[model samples]
Target: MMYKHFRHGDLLKQWAEQAEARIAPRIREIEKRVEFHQWRLLEAYRQTGVSEQHLSSSTGYGYDDMGREALEEIVARVFGAEAALLRPHITSGTHAIAACLFGVLRPGEELLYITGPPYDTLTQVIGEEQDGTGSLADYGIGYQAVDLTPEGKVDWPAVQKAIRPQTRCIAIQRSRGYSERASFSVEAIGEMVEKVRRLCPDAIVFVDNCYGEFVEDQEPSHVGADLIAGSLIKNPGGGLAKSGGYIVGRKKWVDRAASRLIAPGILAEGGATYGYLRDFYQGFFLAPHVVGEALKGALFASAVLEAAGFETTPRYDEPRTDLIQLIRLQDPKRLIAFCQGIQAASPVDARFLPEPSPMPGYEDPVIMAAGTFVQGASIELSADGPLRPPYLAYLQGGLTAAHVKIGVLTALDRMLTHSPSESAKLER
Candidate 1:
């Protein structure tokens, strides 16, 4: 009966029903992960004695802020890390990752990415070529990347060959970002960490844990990563954190990253919470459940889109390590229309249509449909991608599965009505 309110056609409705039936087992699997993570986080909160007093805000110097310290302890306990830095001062995931990189590597040392080039925003941070900007390369730090094999697995042989005396950091990006490759599972990351340790025992194994948090039973820190960083606005924010980022790992590395975030002496000792502590603590507590909802939405999108003849990575039944559901629309118009539909379903700014435009830190024009409460929050339903070949649309995040279902089905309706060829293919 609720379906009657939407503009979906009879055929589209039938296809949706079939997709839901096919993905029911997978949905149950995601629920299991949610339950496990929820209990795990609850235990962390209890062990850390999270109380109302620990949710208060800090002022000015923020020195001896018990709430700030407690929250960091909770994050560290949940992630199985020696320490954690949770601060609003660190603006984004890229910033957190950059701090970790700058904190660990000296001027002569190098950072090697085993999972190929990182997300687009990081290209500048790594400074593939030394520009006048203060990128890692500008500071005399070296960077190298080993591409994944054709099968989308780590190039172990290439990784072995790429190691040098100055290689001080081995970085792994757990999510696929905008690429078509599969996201690395926690087990796979552990394997990479073990091999990297064998090749360079002292090398810091870092993971960019952006959209990959809470999707797995154990985090990369639980495996063998020496350091990991992510944006609070992504999975870990639980759609509640207004703004922030987190870095967790070995105490020494976390302390170094804190130093990079603030100053040497103020490492994890400064930065006022400014009334965001309640949101951060509550958001973290709700993250596991919220991430589970996003995962379900991703699965549903994969099933529906794949049935509609669009090529989708990590098919509905596949194991997921992140929230991204990539759809290759093969045409720019359809890509735009897809994002428009997602925006139309959004709770905020739905009246505005998204357009492709140049954004800083990216090489190509990008179209983003993020009508979220928090600016640029991917934990809420959003779709975005570059305006380039294959016209891929990367759909991520939904606070609720019903919202994703309506949004994606609406997108399918819009695309089918606009493209006769697409409708004809579905008809056949």
Candidate 2:
């Protein structure tokens, strides 16, 4: 009956059913993790004593805004950090990360990326090409990177050699952004922190924590990271926060980052919530369960898509450190059709076709299918990728497993109809 409403073919329906049966055990594993994190978050809220008074908003200057302060404290406690900076002023994950980098490192200091080059958007922020648009390089800050080994693991020897006297900040990206490598787990990050501390004792260990929140039982902050940053729209927002970002870490580091967000002397004391406090608090409180739902959707998509004859990273049964599910479509047409199907199944903008277009921060033309209630919120069901070799499609987020099933089945149907060759491959 549901298939008839969505117009999915019988073959696709059968495939989905079989995939669901095969992944039932794995889904149960994710549910257990969800329960653990949900309890942890609930305890954080209780310990913080969140109440109706803390939900109120504040106006200009935002002096003594109890709600904002309490929400930040709750977030910091949940993430196992000494302090936190939660603000609508920090626009994106990239912005939050930039604030941390600029806040901690001085003009003469250097930033070393140990995991590899960060996400595409950060390339400009680091001024790798030096366009002089007020990047770190423009401000006299230097940058260096240690590439991951051929097998996609951290190159420890290279990392040791890369550290220098000027290296003030050591950055690790937990998510595999537009890359074929696996996302780093929190345990792996702990090992990295230990090694970094031994190699460069004074260097700041900063993690780009976007898309990786609530995926594990513990956060990077708990694993000896000096600082961590992420966007609210990605995972911690729980699909409700309109816009915001968070930075959590050592008290001094968080204070420095806060100074960058709101000028010094008034650091962390000025930004008004303007009625967004309730969303921020409630969104965070619900984040763990919401992340669990997204993880289930990701698993369902992986199992169904892989069964339909496509390559997927971190197969359905593999351990997950982030919500992203990378599907290798191998053809531009297949990629477009996949995105179109996802868009067509979207609760919003279902009739509009998504095309590959040049986005501001990315180098290649990127195609995205996001019909979320909040603009560009990845915590809702969406798929996107760059138009390049292998033509990998990156799928992430769903408020519910049912929605993800519909979207993925619709995508498979589109792909099967678009290419007879692919359909034959599926049949065989």
Candidate 3:
């Protein structure tokens, strides 16, 4: 019933077989990277002397909790940061980043972005596009940006010229958020940091490091990032963290972020770990292998999608720095159909149809097909994108490459088959 409906089902099978062989070497290389990161994580755990006692939770102010203290130390050491803030109180990656931004910046200061507009969700946080919700701009923090060059590289000259006396922070988004561009490498971020220091020696260099963790041997902090933030449910969570975020950087910045996360006087003292410490610790340990699995899945997805006559960013053979895999459907119906097929493959909510609708912190009506245990965890196999032009579907995360292969094949089958009635549903 499946292949009988798909005109190109045979082609999809042939392409997948070929891609598996072609990508074998790449998969081996990713496996090596995973092993290296695992060693690094083990060393951090050893350095911090994490013990079973460190897995217990503390309630009623959560002060003097040895596990909490050691967890923070391990995270900071692993990230090459002077200090770190790891708290379940910090709800989302966006919340963690906002805490750092508000903590270090004053009302009169300016925030400059060397990397065009940030992710869509952050636009609302920056108050660049008004959402009627209070944001950094509402508090008088000014925001400005310098778009990347046509080739997707940093516009260094513009960045240098844009630096002002009021410029208090320079925001660098490491991943290509909702855009078809190359994500910045850790080495590239270091170069950007050096240039910024040359122009404004005192301005803080902040990196939105979502989706970039464990994908490299070194982090933004290792390359001179003064402040960096990310969500635990992403790469670092290893698909296990139920909720939380992290901020790692200089002691002063982390301290300020702590103040913002809790109350000014409490400052990292009152937040409770609620017995999630063990999962968080275990997640960090497993993150390297899990992230490697996601990357291999993306590479394989790229190969199969391209062979199916659709365009893909960072073709399977291209270098990757993040988990996102963009596919260009170029039509709303096809986009919806692709998402529906992806949703169908989900282990949870497979029977539910995903519809395009407005979500908080985004401008467009976005369509998403995610059935992750962590609720929007991108580290699991998921796909989503805005229902706007280019009609791109940003597919990311797969706990295993075999699952990703199945999802891709399923989507291709649905795209090529499906009754006119089902097509009408997509058209709706």
Candidate 1 lDDT at 274 equals 91
Sort all candidates by lDDT, best to worst. Answer: 1, 2, 3
The residue-by-residue lDDT of candidate 1 on 1-428, one tens digit each, is: 65565555777788788889989999889899889988888898898888999889989989999999998999999999999999998889999999999999889899999999999999888885567788999989999999999999999999999999999999999999888899999999999999999999989999999999999899999999999999999999899999999999999999999888999998999989998999999999999889999988898899988777878988998888999999998889999989998998889999999999999988889999998999999999999999999989999999999899989988888787788887788777
Q: What tens digits encode model 2's per-residue C-alpha lDDT throughout 1-428?
A: 77775434777878888889978998888889888988888988898898899999999999999999988888888899999999887899999999999899888889999988999999888895456798999888999989999998999999888888999999999999999999999999999999999999999999999999999899999999999999999899999899999999999999899888889998898899898998998888788888888888898898888788788987888999999999998889999999999999999999999999999889999999998988899899999999998999999988888898889988888888778887777867
Write down the worst ten-residue block by lDDT for model 1. 1-10
For each candidate, the alpha-carbon lDDT, in order, equals: 0.91, 0.91, 0.87
Q: Candidate 3 at 132: error in angstroms? A: 8.3
Residue 141 shift from truth in candidate 2, angstroms: 0.8
Poorly placed runs, candidate 3 (over 4 Å): 1-9, 128-133, 419-428
Best by lDDT: 1
Per-residue CA lDDT of model 3 for 1-428, tens digit only, reads 35444555666677788778878888988999999999999999998888889999888788887888898999999999999888887788899999999899988899999999888888777885334567888878899999999999989889888888999999999998888878988999999999899899999999999999988789999999999999998999899989899999999888898888887877766677888899989998999999999999998898887766779987888877788889988888878888888898899999999999999878889999997778988899999989899999999898888888878888877876665654344333
- For residue 201, model 1's alpha carbon misses the true position, in angstroms, by 1.1
User: Candidate 2 has what TM-score?
Assistant: 0.98
**Where does candidate 1 clash, by residue pair?**
none
- How many residue pairs collide in each prediction? 0, 0, 0
Q: Which stretches of candidate 1 lie over 4 Å from their true place?
A: 5-8
Query: For candidate 1, what is the TM-score?
Result: 0.98
Candidate 2, superposed: residue stretches over 4 Å from native:
5-8, 129-131
